[model samples]
Target chain A: MIGRFVARRAAMLVATALVASVAVYGALFIAPGDPATLLIGGGKPPSPQLLAEIHRQYHLDDPFLQGYLRWLGGMLHGDAGQSLTYKDSVTHLVTERIGNTAFLVAYAAVLIIVPGVTLGTVAALRGGFGDTLVTVVTTALMAVPTFVMSVVLIWWLSVQWDWLPAYGAGEGFTGRLEHLTLPALALATAWLAYVAQVTRSAVRAELASEHVETAWARGVPERFVVRKHVLRNAAGPLFSVSGVAVAGLIAGCSIVEQAFGINGIGALLVQSAAKQDLAVVQALALITVVVFVVVNTLVDVVTAALDHRVSLEGTA
Target chain B: MTGSPPLLVVDDLRVDLPTRDGMRRVIHRADLTVPAGTAVALVGESGSGKSMTARAVLRLLPSRARTTGSVRFDGSEVTTLGAAGLRRLRAHDVAMVFQDPRAHINPVRTVGDFLTEALITTRGVRPRAAEAKVTALLREVGIADASRRMRQRPPELSGGLLQRVMITAALAGEPRLLIADEPTTALDVTTQAEVMAIIDEARAERGLAMLFITHDLALAAAVCDRIAVMYAGGVVEELPARHLHERAAHPYTRALLASRPDPAATAEPLRAVPGRPLSAFETGPGCAFAPRCAHAQDLCHTERPSLSPAGEGLAACHFPAADARVTPQPGARSTPHGR
Candidate 1:
């Protein structure tokens, strides 16, 4: 049963990517941006002959369907055409920058899920005073937007305290990790509060459920009941909520990247979009769509695995 | 009520819960006893504290609730038992089956997990061995394809099937006593009979003592050897099952007996008590049922009555019904110890 279920999910993942890729490519194609004009210098008016030569070189005069087909075929292989301004392979540019974004997102994911779930569980388990404290702190944190959090964190942790570097992706593993810490924290601030609140409500609901009561009444020890019954039952919601937060992170934190001077994919997308670098934009957009679809698809599978009822409903 | 030693005794149990008005009592006074290998039914309407009394046996009360009475199981006080002792009692000596089996079970888990979790975790039985044990117990509870049912989750099973699974879990502990809290209240009439039959047969085969809680007095009298009728958190009467209809001493007990529609006499109008049932906190110093009692005199309105020997049972009424002999209906079903 599990094998068949996973097979269906795999099919869904591929189908979702196929549909989204087409939409992103088509939308970007129709969007107002001329690559040939972008490639020629904007400082001086170029002759018509030079413009036509550039258009033919990039196949800008080709029909939309033919151009899309060519682009799709090239993407199937290890090619994404060439950048308009940088005159480099779009694929190589994306690959070089994707790693930094991936690291930043992973760092932010931990900052969001770990502390969020821990505080949420504490709030649920310890009612009265402690619960209100966690709630108040998270609520206040949530009110601060990501850019403001970035500014405040830099002001307090980096600038005033002189505790950590305020900019750049840094060098090597430890150095990069240390420098990325502040950016990840800023990016995770609002979402951490969101996940924490969601987890608190979910855990509290599970605790009040009859199943947890049954486990307690059966003489299951407290630790076992909390781990096996309460948390295990609450796992589906946690996975889903965190999955969304992390998947959104994969699209890239442009604001954080800009604030911290990190040359990640978010910065690349913003820079490329400003210059009308359609090739890089198209590639990154495709990757973002795939990442989002894949993350949510994974969430569905894990959720169905944790909860049999969901799997049944999914198949039904 | 029997010569056998009492397996469980609850004496003058009172549970107070926190409320906006202050500490309000939910269980005013409840006393019950279940002899070894005998079934005793605590029957009452909704909000009668029958379920609360059953829950107190396992020390399963709200964290903020305060209690004033003692619960003894196998001659040891359960009310004051330490954490370890409570765990030991719940694990080996007693187990409870809840009202809604679906709501009480982890829906994500297979029946096997629900059944063998305690055995593997607390009892230290090997996983494979626990699985085999619960599988056998499942078969005993009338689940023919025990192995297949074990792999299935709760939502896949019908109400009757899930109740059988609950019975298996309850019996898996091999406890001396089982507390069934309205085990069949959520099922339809036909399924109710089947589920009750499974519990009855399982209890008989294991020779387990049972404290059955239900609002159906007829089913209680049929299945249990003794009956304890509760009113507004207090057990108002205790009597042998055979005397539930004709020899019941308390007016509240008689009123319940009358309130049940007589199926054979369809031409007669249905009977209902005069006042709505009161919760434990709603009662005053006087008898909780006084406003609805036909025999409520000035004295009955002023002071509450304690359990005193009346007719063939113990009653908590100032005026125990003495005219039962004149009102004996030959249509009353003769229910002996259901074997």
Candidate 2:
């Protein structure tokens, strides 16, 4: 049963990634300006002979369908063409900066998971004032946009306190972690609130569920009841919601990376798009799509694995 | 009940619930006893506090509800037990089977995990040993293929199977008292009969005392040695099971017996109980069932009659169906406030 579930999820991931890659590649064709400019980076005006040589070399004269198929075939073979702005290899540029985005996502995920889940659990287990306090705090956190949060965090933590660096990716693990803290927190704000609210509701619902009451009556100690029964039951929602919060960091990471002056892929995409660098934009778009598809698939798989009802009976 | 002393004694229990309206007494008064190795049925209509009284045995009432009562198990007061005491009671001395087995077992967990949890956690029984013991208990409850069922989740099994798992889990701790609260309510007729038979056979085999809660009078009579009929938050009558059909003294008990369909007399109309059942909070100053009682008089409306000896057992009525009536039992008294 587990084998089948994994097989199905893997198939879905592959199919979704393929569709997203096609869409990303097609976006390059639909872009404004010359096709030859896309192929040759347009840094200098091209002669007719040079244009013809480029067109023939790239099969630009072929029909749109053939061209797309050729491009897709080339992408599969690790030939993603060149950026119109930097005129650099798209794979090299993307691979170089994706690591930073991955690190930032990990940092922000740490921020989101720890406090988000704790506050939610506190709200659920200790009601009345604790519930109201969590509600108010999470509401305030979510109400602020990520960029605004970024600016404010920088102003306070960097300028006022002078405790951390304001911009630029720092060297080494410790330095980078130190420099990334404020940006990571800024990126984590809205998503942290999202995870917290989801956790709160999930815990509340699980607490009222009959099985949990049964656990209590069975004299399973309070801690085990909360751990094995309550939190374990709530884990399904937490997995999927936390996955979305992290995978959705693309948008937040873009703004935070720019505000922090970090050399990350999200910021690079924005810069590339502004310069009409179709290759870099397409690559980053495909990467974003792949990240969402993979992360969501992994979340669902984990959820199914954790829950027998979901795995054997399929999700309800 | 013969030769064995009472294992559980619940006397003059009252529970007050906080609702949207106000604080209402849900369990006005509940009194019953289960001698060691005997089964007692708490029979009642909906909202009569049958389940509430059962829950009170373990302090499992809602958070805001106020309760004052005496619940003793094996000569120890259950209500006053500390946390560790209560845990010991629930884990080792008493175990419960709920109405809907599907709802009571965690859906995500395997049947084995649930069955072995108390054994592992409370008894300090090793996991492998617990599994072996649980498997034996499962077969004892009539589940033949225990291992396969253990690995399966709750949703994968039928209601009867899940209920058998509940019974297995209940017996896992080898508790002296088993509280079966409408254990077969959610099953189909065939499954209900099977589950009840399993419970009856298992309880008898283990010499375990049971408090069976159900609405079915005949079922109660069949599985329980004694039947305590509840009416609107109070036990209106308590009598030996065999005497239930013949010597029922309370008007409500007689009415309930008459309400059952007589299969042999196909042409006769079914005798439905008059008026809808009243909830715990909705009772009046008089007897809770007095408004719908055919034998009710002016005095009956003025005050409530407490449980008094009548015939083989006890009945709470100003005018019982048996010859003893008009002159109330000597020690039986009424308070100004009926509740």
Candidate 3:
């Protein structure tokens, strides 16, 4: 089983890499601006001498295959070539901003994931008042977009109450946590609402299942019934959804990061896009793709661990 | 005084289910007693209140189900017991085996896990002790290579094997009264007999009282010491196994007996009751079985009759079978003679 999972994951990663490479190459080649014009940025047509210099600088003067192979080789070495506007390596720029985003994601996950899922389970078990209250609260939160939530939190917690830092990671770990809190909340609000709904519904379905009634017939205590049977059985779907939630966070945090002025990967991607830096943009997109692939892969692994019904061969 | 008291005693039991409109009685005024180590069958068609009777005995009915009547186990009134008290009762005194054994065992859980769970929780058996008990139970249920089968999930096991596992799980708590609701309905005939034999062996070995609920009268006659035939929501007749076959007094019971395919009557058409049972929600001042009872009269159609002594046993009809007074076996009365 372990061998099968490892083999499947390896195959999936290869497929994902091949697809990402195609997308990266296509986005750079098919866009309106040529590399020469973007590199020099002259209003009129560039002089032949300047154009030649630009082509030579970027190795674009080489054959298409040669240029593509050279770029692919650089990627294999973890060097994503140089950013056109920043005058730095795309790899270095992504790495620096990625750590800050990772920190923010970790904090939000801690705050939201555990309590959110637990509340959903509780609401499902104790239906009437608790379930209705949770349903209303989560639905209301879901209606508000992440940016809207960020702005509200900024207005109330940061500006009005002056509670936590509004932007950027400060010196220490604790300082970074303070700065990341609002943006993390903004991101977590939507995900938490979704998780709560999923967990509650799954738990309710499991609780009403014939197996649960049979468990009760066996005289198993209500608590053990809820924990060992209900939670364990319902957790498979919850883990898969949460995996998507994490991937969504990586792909979607651009707006949230920008709203808070945090120099995270999302904000960096947006900055690189505005400057039309293809290497930085391609590199950032590649990182996001890797994050999504790896996150979903881990989700599959967790789902396989929890549910014996999932077959590695079939999924692959 | 030294002898064991009745294991399960139910008197004037009533269960009402609340619906959107109003309260409707599900099980009406049922009274029964099962002596220690005795097996009694509650035979009835669907919606005959047999399952409800079993559920009422265990206090396992849903919260919306309002049960108002005496359900005494050993000596205590079960209806008045608190949730914790009921749980203790279920764990130690009266464990129930449900219908659809496949659904009874968790599909995702292994047979060993279910066995161990009941043992540890109900009996307070430690892991080592529970494992030993589980192994013994599997063997006792006649599962060949029991240890290997224990490692498999219910889905991996056949229907018969799953039912045996259910019996084993029920036995884990060492319950006195085992309420089996159509335990063999899902199995083939051969497997059903085998499963029934296993249950008999287990019950005999443990000196357990059993309430076997089923619609098959012949199967009930083959297994039970006494049979109670339910029609609509009430038991129309109660008698010993032989008496149920030879002296079935109620019109519904007679219809059920005649409906059984007769090998002797090779040319005669099979007999069946004409219509479905009356709806539970349909209110009536008359007999619920009047529409289907061939012997129903102005009295049977206008007034409901409670169970009364027809001959040696109870029948709910105004007129018992005239020829049913002669007991089939002269010595048969010795088996179930009671106060």
Instruction: After superposing candidate 3 on the true structure, give the runs of residues whose Cα lies further than 4 Å from its correct spot.
Output: A42-45, A59-69, A312-316, B1-5, B18-24, B263-269, B324-339
lDDT of 1 by residue, B40-154 (tens): 9999999999999998999888889898888989889998999999888988999999999999999988999999998887799999999999999888878899999999989
Answer with 1 or 2, whichever has the higher TM-score: 1
The deviation in Å at residue B231 for candidate 1 is 1.4
Off by over 4 Å in 1: A33-35, B1-5, B20-22, B329-339
In Å, residue A225's CA in model 1 sits off its true spot by 0.8
Superpose all Cα atoms of candidate 2 onto the true structure and report the RMSD in Å to 1 decimal.
Answer: 4.0
Chain B alone, TM-score, model 2: 0.93
Tell me the docking grade of candidate 3: medium
- After TM-score superposition, what is the CA distance of residue B263 in candidate 3 from its true location, in Å? 4.8
How does the DockQ of candidate 1 come out? 0.72
TM-score ranking of the models: 1, 2, 3
> TM-score of chain A for candidate 1?
0.96
Per-residue lDDT of candidate 3, residues B1-339 (tens digit): 147667777777888888887888887757777888888999988987889888888776777788887889998888998888888887788877777887767776688988899778766789888978888878888887888987877767889888888888888888888899999898888898898898888888888889999999888998888888877667777888876766666778877887888898899988777788764456377777888877667887777778887655787777566434333444333222111
TM-score of each: 0.94, 0.92, 0.92
On a 0 to 100 scale, what is the lDDT of residue A61 in model 1? 79
